[model samples]
Target: MEQRLSYLKQHLQQNDIGMAFIQGKANLFYFTGFRCEPHERLVSLMVFPNAEPCLVCPNMEVSLAKEAGWQLDIIGYSDHENPWEKIQQFTSDISFQGTMLGIEGELLSFSRAEQLKNAFPLTEWTKLDNIFMDLRLIKNEKEISVLREAAKLADFGVEVGVHALQSGRTEMEILSMIEFELKRKGISEMSFGTLVLSGEQSANPHGKPSMKTIQKGEFILFDLGVVLEGYCSDITRTVGFGAISDEQQKIYNTVLKAQLDTLEMCKEGTILGELDRKARSIITDAGYGDFFPHRIGHGLGTEVHELPSLNENNSDVLKVGMCFTIEPGIYVPSVGGVRIEDDVLITTDGYECLTAYPKELQMIK
Candidate 1:
């Protein structure tokens, strides 16, 4: 955390920015080692170019922040108090007129921006989102370790879901079993909603689980991930319930081949856009181009989806220590859909596949 703060401070000094007000929960945790959801309340880290940084949060979370290893001044305000006034009082030494302030423009709401403008009138506002993205683009050894564990848990989730599969069962019934078993293993949160789409429902990429019953000779898709120790993992797998059609087998093979081919391109110095193009080309050649809608993958770490999106237009080059997903799918309207995904980390030689729940077609008899 200290290193991250120092890096941000250096950037502020270099850019001639006087102060930075960071409010996003993920950004806060990245710099201060403290995480909280202050819904409707103002919680931020006030950083200065030449002065010590201070944490501002609700009065109820002061001790928790301290326990999170934040060794700095904390200004805790009650629910009724005006936090803007407290901020004004705390930053009295700094001149607001003509001063440059950095903020996350994407995460900051319009009302919040107006309040900031009123609090520090005449200050110029700049975006700090790109800076944060650059800082978190590469994962260190410690982060990779946590990601590895998170991926293992995600693989376990798929294993449990596959075992719970049975004919005539509702999608929600199997979905509940997956979460209940995860809870029994002490996992309290999922990175996203657990998705259990079956048969024609799987044709929708972002379909939700429902009471729709699972039938034989159809596909059951499981897309899920678990949040472990502030990190996240995401994996997707589609399995056969019983005897599937020949066209279904061909679709599954095409998706698998595309995903594998894309994974092989996950090496240091490779262009980010090429990964998506490779996968898309393979699927298109197999006559399923229109069905593959989304990009190849997205970066994964503190958040399930982060920087360095893998699409056909991204010019960024892949580097070692970069982690992202490589997911390819074919969603047909009436037939069904098939998607195979994996969490991967770029290495000097090639890449490491973190989510190892088998990609081959799984037939549950």
Candidate 2:
């Protein structure tokens, strides 16, 4: 903890940044070790260059914040005392005059930012998106351990999903089955909603569960993750119901091979974008390039999507202890889609595969 504090302090000093005000849930947890409330409550975490960080929250959460031993100072706000006034009173006393403050650009809203500007007009606000992104690119020992287990729980969820995927099963029923299995594996909370799509609906990556039932020779897509100890793991696999056509089998094989080939090239010091390109190349060569439209993969940690994205534009280098997912897909619109995802950890030598569920085409005939 002390080392982390010193590291952050030195980073702030080197950058000549005055303070980092965090409003997002994951950001607050990473900087202050407090993650109870969502970002909606107007709570902020202020990290100064050489002093103990502080947390601003509602009056009811003051005790809970104290229990976490995160913030050195806890400022409280109440409904009786105007929330905005309390915020101004608290920040006005701080050493914020003429200081260049950093804020989470994407997570902090325009309304809340306006409030901060009105509170301290002299203090300039800089976006901290790149700064935080760099900090969270590499994972720590504690983080990797939890994510490994989360991957196992996700694999367990996949087992349930495959079993529930029978002919004539509704999308809602399949979701319930996966949730029950996740709970059975000790994953009480989900990192995100379990996605269940059958037949033509499977082509949509973010499609919600519907009343559609499984159709013979059609594709079924399942994307799910389990949260264990605030960490997350995500995996996606497309299976066939009943007898599958040879074309579907060929497509599934192509995606699975692409994923494995990409993982083979992922090592410490590898370029993130290159890894994404490598995956894309294999799928493109197989003639399913147009079907695979999204980025090859993304970073995985405290939140499912963190930093150092694995895409064409990201130039971040892969490092040891960093965990991310490789999900390559081929969506044929109304015909169906095939995507097989796996959470992998960059190791000192090569890469470690965390999701051990089966990737071969499974027919639930």
Candidate 3:
């Protein structure tokens, strides 16, 4: 916690902001060890240049915050007190009186952002969106340990999901069974809703499990992950229902080859855009260029989707100690779709994969 605080202090000074008002609960909890409530009360934090941090939280949660390991000064208010007043009090002591304040621009609601500005009429506040995110790009030892555990648990759950696939079964039935098996394997719960799409349904990249039953010669996409120790793991694998045609096998293999190609190039300091291009080019060569959509992958961490996006547009270079997903897919509206994903981690030595689930096409009878 002290190290994290030190890093944030450095970031605050570098950005030339007097103080940063962190709004996103996920990043807030990481820095202050306090997770804010929803609309019931304003969960606020104030960070001044070269100063110890402080949190403005509901009085009811102050004790919980202390218990969970709050290292800096804490300020609390009762429900009866207007939430804005509490925020004002927090900012008044730490925030610079007539200078710009910083908040997370992406996560804060427009109304809430306006309310905050109104509260601090004397101060000039800005959204230091990238300032906060910049610190989390590289993982520390503790973070990597937790993510490794999340990967193991999530990988086990994917295997369970794969075995649950079969013909004459509804997508929802397989979903229920996989959910049950995941918990049975001691994966407390899925990080996100399990993706169990069959046949034409798989054509949707994020298709919802439906009453549609499985059949022969169609693609089955399974994208699932497990949440453990506050970290997340995400992997996607598509399999053939039964006897797939030559065309279907080709599509499946193309996606598989694309993922494999990207995996070899995910190293420290690798250009992120070039990695996405590697996968896009491979699929394009296979004559399924338009069908293969979305970025190659995204960075994975506490919030599941964090920094270092794997896309044609992202300039964030791949760095050692950063963890992200490599999920490349091909979507076909009627025939079906195929996607094979893996969770890869950049290490000091070389990159290593956390998701060890078999990548070959499985044919469930």
User: Which model scores highest in lDDT?
Assistant: 1
Candidate 2 runs further than 4 Å off? 184-188
Q: For each candidate in the order shown, give its overall lDDT on alpha carbons.
A: 0.92, 0.82, 0.80
Whole-model lDDT, model 3: 0.80
Worst 10 residues of 3 by lDDT: 32-41
Query: Which pairs of residues have clashing backbones in candidate 1?
Result: none
Q: How close to the true structure is residue 211 of candidate 3, measured as C-alpha lDDT?
A: 91
Worst 10 residues of 2 by lDDT: 32-41
Task: Name the lDDT value of residue 270 in candidate 3.
Answer: 89
Q: Please rank every candidate by TM-score, starting with the best.
A: 1, 2, 3
- Write down the RMSD of candidate 1 (Cα, Å): 1.2
Query: What lDDT is obtained when candidate 2 is compared to the true structure?
Result: 0.82
- Candidate number achieving the greatest TM-score relative to the actual structure: 1
lDDT of 2 by residue, 82-121 (tens): 6667656666676556788888888877888888788768
What tens digits encode model 1's per-residue C-alpha lDDT throughout 192-228? 9999999999999999899999999889999999888
> RMSD of candidate 2 to the true fold?
1.9
Ranking by lDDT: 1, 2, 3
